[model samples]
Target: MDYLSRTKRQYWIVLFVCFLIYNALIVGLWLLLHSLGSHFHVANDIALLICSVFGLLLMIVFSSIISKYLIEPLKAIWQLILHISPSGVAVPAPNIDSLKTGRELVANLAMQVYQLTAVAGQYGTKAADSELNNNFVANKLPLPLFILDSGETIIYANIAASDYIGTPVKDLTGKNFYMVMDMSFPSESTLDKWLKDVKANTATASMSWERVRLNVLDNHPTRLFDLAAFYNKDNPQNYETMLVLFDHTKQYSQDDQAVSFVALSVHELRTPLTLLRGYIEAFEEELGNEMNPDLKDFMQKMGATAQQLNAFVNNILNVARVDNDQLQLSLHEEKWDSIVESAITNIALRAKVRGIKLESHIEPGLPTVGVDRLSIYEVLNNLIDNAIKYSNDSKVIKIDAHLTHEGMIETTVQDFGVGISPNIMSNLFTKFYRDHRNRSQIGGTGLGLYLSKAIVSAHGGNIWVRSTLGQGSIFGFTLKPYTMLAEEIKNSDNKDIVRGAHGWIKNHSLYRR
Candidate 1:
């Protein structure tokens, strides 16, 4: 039998034995009283009544002693044991002073047992408290965090995650991660492949999704989130995975709206600027020889200013297109010399106005490149223009092109200018970022380099700048060389087949020319 049940049975047996002894003492006293009454000639009724009263008084006294010395102390000890049980309650220590010596020994033994049990349970209580603290911290965090078991089952989710998923925390537990997320990918196997790559440690365990709908309910807004997964090393054989999510929905929306507004406003301003430039060019063309030299120069300056404004507008439009993923390119095989000449000719007027000499060095027999000709021309123009603006007292600007050992064409535009500082260089190509030191000294919309970087990246290349603060700066980019394969395709008579085979060769081009 269990300890509680055996103890209860023993208690009942003790009570029964006490009852029998009390009754035997009462019966013996009554018999003796009756015999004394008969010897002393007293009434039998009076003797019986007296014996009954004495028996009742004796029972009451014995009951009070048992309850005070035994029952009450035992009850308190039993309550203390229950309090220290796994149920996590607290009870006051029992008072053993009211008990007689032998009963007090039993009470002390019970108290010792309670103390030992409390010591044994201390570690478990601490562990429980630690877990409670961890959960509290996780739930209080702003970002959503989830803990998954070895089977990719979500064992725990923070309050933010539960709110994001539109489910209660208890309901979310035991759900599979993929089912809870309900991710959509380009192809059916894309998610599987990504998971496999993450598990195999062949790819980064972080990913982002645009316009991800967290809830299955209709009309739910989509959000962008950066999700990262990491293995929990606490258990080696059955490790857990921690998933964290950061929301970027509001930021992306604000950026999109800002870019659209700038693009629209700049597009509207371009029309009047174009008309002003046309009028200036017409006036110069009609009265150039007959007009005074100063007047001619004034007209020329007006034209240059107009052209600069138009270029800034174009940069703004290009930035918007790139941000919206609407920049389309018409790629073709073009000779490096022809592309370079066109870019130089376009920027020659600006370079001459700044008194900065333009120089070029092209390695002989440099292979033709597959690129969007006009886009590359814009890149070169922006770099040279930037060089001319920053060249405080320097006069020489060099443009060099050569074939790299990796079979790619590398082009560099070096200028003897007030070079960029290390702090500004890193953020030079970020959209809408202006160098605080040069913003007042030089006039620019800060989108030129950003557009250049975007154009180069679209051509499957990279662009970077190197500079020493007082010396000079060099801007360089690499492009894939046009191969015999491109030549064969260009020479082929099957135009329809070429159009069908290549997706990048679409004719509905929207990019700046």
Candidate 2:
């Protein structure tokens, strides 16, 4: 039967038993009183009156007990259920253990329900508090962040994002994401297409686009943002996209100024250095026979110093050009043998001074390469000069060239020196990167390898290095073998020949032995 029906039956049975017991006690008292009255020759009305008064008092006491133990506790439990809230359940102290069997069962059931509700309420409170804390932290972040819903609505935005758009976050929400931020692309169709793609690819955990332009609606300056969008794994269909913006304008401007300064300074310095070299050469030519041997040697040293300065200046200029994206190559068909021979001859004096032996092995019948002769010469000169400087006790450098399986000419500059460690090898060709271990021992601007890599890449080639820590190092680069089609293209009347994309060169895979 239901709890209510069972409780009603128990109540009826308890009342019936109480009635019977009260009647039995009253009857016994009457009987005893009657006998005492008879024995003492007292009035029967007095005995009967006393018994009735006592019976009424007994009924009152039993009713009070039932009200306190059963009625009050059950009423409080019912009130608690009715007033339940996330905060907690409200109920008076319960004496469920002292109650009769039927009332105690009802009381226990009510307590269990209250306990479950209290536990659930506690969990709900904790979850709400955690969400509030997360929101607080997100709003305090320095970078602008936005939470956009699936319909491209601005459901949430942080304080930085608000300041960026010159509006309060409250005003920003409930508005179309693109409308509030005023993000634009090179073309409207491009923006539409990108948005479509992002929405369609919901399976992607996170997506990012760098260097996106943000056009503020409140007349604030437009800025570049590295935007990232992510989904809530639990509720992907309804989750918001997290867009973060990282500013890089100041960094770009600083880099631009630095490159311009280097380019200008190098140009200004080259003219005077050229004049000094010319004068030194002229002096040596005029007074060679009359001057003492020691003086002639000094003049020749001055000449060599001037030449080294000129080369250093050239390197700085070229590096600046690369940074400014002004590097251009004049492609022409050049015999690889003659190019290598010329580079070796130019560095012969330096090699002799350093007591380093230079060796070259060119494959017979090697095809000519399409390249800018001057740029390739610079690459060879830089590699050989580095090899000489790091030759250590083993003063040997070798240059080898042969046709690769890909039909490209691969040239390697090998040096028996303190080979590069694994940690430093990865960053060897990065601009302005110098090995801390060798920086004190070697004098270099750290731009030679970087520039060489850039020039080689411009010719649609790849460059890499392989080295053992203490054994030796081999730096290699590939060049496209000259073909009739490439020759014809080079011979075309077009003076502006652009080969590769103008940007940083990614490291090619290291050529394994």
* Per-residue alpha-carbon lDDT of candidate 1 for residues 1-513, written as tens digits (9 for 90 to 100): 354454455566667877888888888987887778778987878877887898889789878855654566467667656744666776755555554323444454565764465355433442242342244346667888887776788877888988876778878888988788775543343444555666676423555434443435565666656565665434332325777888866886686677769866986897799799889988988988998977876787777678777777777777778888888765676677777866787677677766679999999999988776767777887888888888889999999999888888999999888888998888999888887888889988788899999999988888989999989899999888878337644764433321211133445333222
Angstrom error at residue 411, model 2: 1.0
TM-score of 2: 0.45
Instruction: Report residue 352 deviation for candidate 1 (angstroms).
Output: 1.7
Residue 277 deviation, candidate 1, in Å?
1.7
Model 2, 1-513: lDDT tens digits are 476677777778777878888899999999998888878976988887899899999989878865654575466566545554444655544455554646645555765665565355434432242332234346667888877667878777788988876888789877988777766543444334655775676544565665567765455666766666665433432434667778765674566578778867987998898799789888988998999988977786677667667777878888878888989877766678878887787777677656678999999999978877678778988888888878888878999999999899999999989889998888999999887888899888899999999999998899999999788899999999878338555566533432221111223212110
| Top-scoring candidate (lDDT) | 2
| Prediction 1 TM-score vs. true | 0.46
82 Cα displacement, candidate 1 (Å): 64
